[model samples]
Target: MEQKRDDTARDAVPAFDWDPRSEEVQADQIAAYDAMRGRCPVALGAQGNWAVFGHADNRAILEDPRSFSNAVSAHLTVPNGMDPPEHGPYRAIVDKYYTPWRMHAFEPTCRRIAHRLVAGLARDTEVDAMAALAEPFANEVQCAFMGWPETLHGPLREWTRKNQAATLRLDRKAMSAIALEFDGYIREQLETRREARTSGAEPPMDATTELLGEQIDGRPLTDEEIVSIVRNWTVGELGTIAASVGILVRFLARHPDVQGDLRARRHDAGLLARASDEILRIDAPLIANRRRTTREVEVGGRIIPAGERVVVLWASANRDEAVFDHADEFRLDRNPADNLLYGEGIHACPGAPLARLELSVLLQELLGATASIEPAGEEPRRAAYPSGGWSTVGVRLA
Candidate 1:
């Protein structure tokens, strides 16, 4: 039967079916999303936006960028928030940074950072993995990748916390302020590089400095554009990467059989990579990504009108039982293409190569260095919306 669209759908708002920010939903995001997928796959959220929960629906939205646009925000977001034609040039520049050669060259530095952090983890005692290892690993690796100094690590970590807090509260004012604060950090770095170049003191040819020489449309990228690009990259590294570590460690700590298998295959990069991706698929690190409807569209029996906002729920879709048998089961045999961990389509994460490298190396080092990692006596705290994984992953490393 053909689905009927209401004539007033263009102006009429749909009644919200779920409160995404409610205490109930936030308490157990994965379970709540799972229920939502079954009850209302395309839900009208309390935030006045639609949350697409089904895997097929989410994939369709991601692939059909024309119907669902990426220009969801008014503020400049470089390639991430731009549609095609406009997004292509900036994306080209971003992709160059994460090429095979770059990832291979940066592997030693990444491994070194991971090894140092893993080595410092206390053995046979309860520790908050997020603070003791995950956060620091992400911060140091990100800083090292961009040629940022140790001084920025503390500030960057704190900034990420504030950013997540502001986002959860939907505090636009606070978010704007935090955005400016981060921009200041990037601006200072850009200025320092420019000053060095002008004063005849050679600036380090790091990622930041390399951005200075990048050209688009025959003109050098503007400072604003550069800062936006770096800001996007920094958020990806600091937020999602850290959450992924917590998830990976917690999963390994709980699943002894899988942990034992991965520990044995620590030297096999391919197996380790697939294992990390599979684990993260079971417990997503990034909750959802935003999009706007360019035209009226039907998704999972719901009609989202033109100009409306939609959130693609990665946490929900990746674990949809329809897509994967026993969605929560950690199986290495699952097809990699079906996993939306790094996303799909044109707007897929440009930093996936770098992210995969960091996670794979960190796991190898962590598994190689420790005899065992298991959950502590204390309960783990789940991160709220806009963030995924545990906030305090209480675990004992031995």
Candidate 2:
């Protein structure tokens, strides 16, 4: 369905194209969002999609699942891709896995992983934080959560990178090949778990078990559904967590005052958590989330027709001046209002608590062990998609 335009409205929203991979491209994307916010809070884009750039407008869209749906696919993000009523029960199956209590139980293991990763960097004066520490740290924690063999970490990381590349590829054959490879990987894991169950050994407490045990609408989920959910988790969690760590470290390095304050307040996990939120606001891992309009609706005074795809620019919304004062600067003192980094509404990320726990422990371990972190010789590389950050961030440990 195409979006309908109101001829009576005088102001015409400008069209903007974006390529998120290049720093120049990203800067331009931000500029475009800022420009749209200045003119109209919500505007129509060149792709015939509605774009909500202002903080308030973005929040409204996120909070109203009835107005917008989360079922975007080929990008099946469990629960992340399901709408309410239908989405609620499926989400509940794994919701408890990320609660504060559950996170607390996982803390010791998280801390251990962080300590080991940071300690490994101690031997090297400078290391690529993304590859040497962040990626491995996220991978190990994910492995711990899924109860999968640790050997899968390397392949998992590789698969995530390939999946991102596949999304950007113009060739259908390339994309299909990547999808086939990942499907095979998931099938292998499922077979391994089934064998364990047959042998009467204790089945692992990982995502596979949790997913296998889950019943949607009182019937067990099919293997295809399980694979879809796990694939989303694997693809979404690993790279983003690794990228976020790099962003946080890079921000601290550039802002010594903030770094010093964080280090001084090391004992306060709450403060550390707030600091993480502020960092996320400053440099979001994902630029936007794609959602398709289900029915004709009005947003920001513009009428959006059904079936048109919309890209909610989360990074722009996080920094919108309407909701955040001094929105451009990183201010830890700012009240961390619900930022849409983990998304919102019925599609709000179920893994948020776990991600938060991993990040907090990583920061705590790094601050406690190292005096300071500085950029090494390597230049930072951003991810191919609009939804990711640094591919490599080298840091010199002090």
> Which candidate leads the pack in lDDT?
1
lDDT of each: 0.92, 0.76
- Please give the lDDT score at residue 129 for candidate 1: 90
Write down the TM-score for model 2: 0.88
Q: After superposition, how far is residue 220 of candidate 2 from its true place, in Å?
A: 1.5
True lDDT of residue 367, candidate 1: 97
Measured against the true structure, the TM-scores of the candidates, in listed sequence, are 0.96, 0.88
Per-residue accuracy of model 1 over 1-398 as CA lDDT, tens digit each: 22345555644664679999899998999999999999999988987989999999999999999999999888889889999989998998999999999999999999999999989989988988999999999999999999998899999989988998898888999999999999999999999999998999999989999999999999999998999899999988899999999999999999999999999989999788899999999999999999999999999987889999999999999999998989988898898999999889999999999989999999999999999999996777689987999879999988
- Candidate 2 lDDT over 1-398, as tens digits, reads 12334642424644544323445644345555676677766766554656778777777888888768887676555667888777887788768677788888889988998998888785436677888887888788887877778788888778776766767564578877887787787888888878889999877776677777778887998888788877777667777788788889888877888899899998888788888878888678777887878899787777788887777888789878877777768776676655777877677778888888888889999999988888777676555546456767877888
Q: Model 2, which residues run further than 4 Å from truth?
A: 1-24, 27-32, 39-48, 74-77, 122-125, 170-172, 378-381
Candidate 1 weakest lDDT stretch, 10 residues: 1-10
lDDT of 1: 0.92
Model 1, clash count? 0
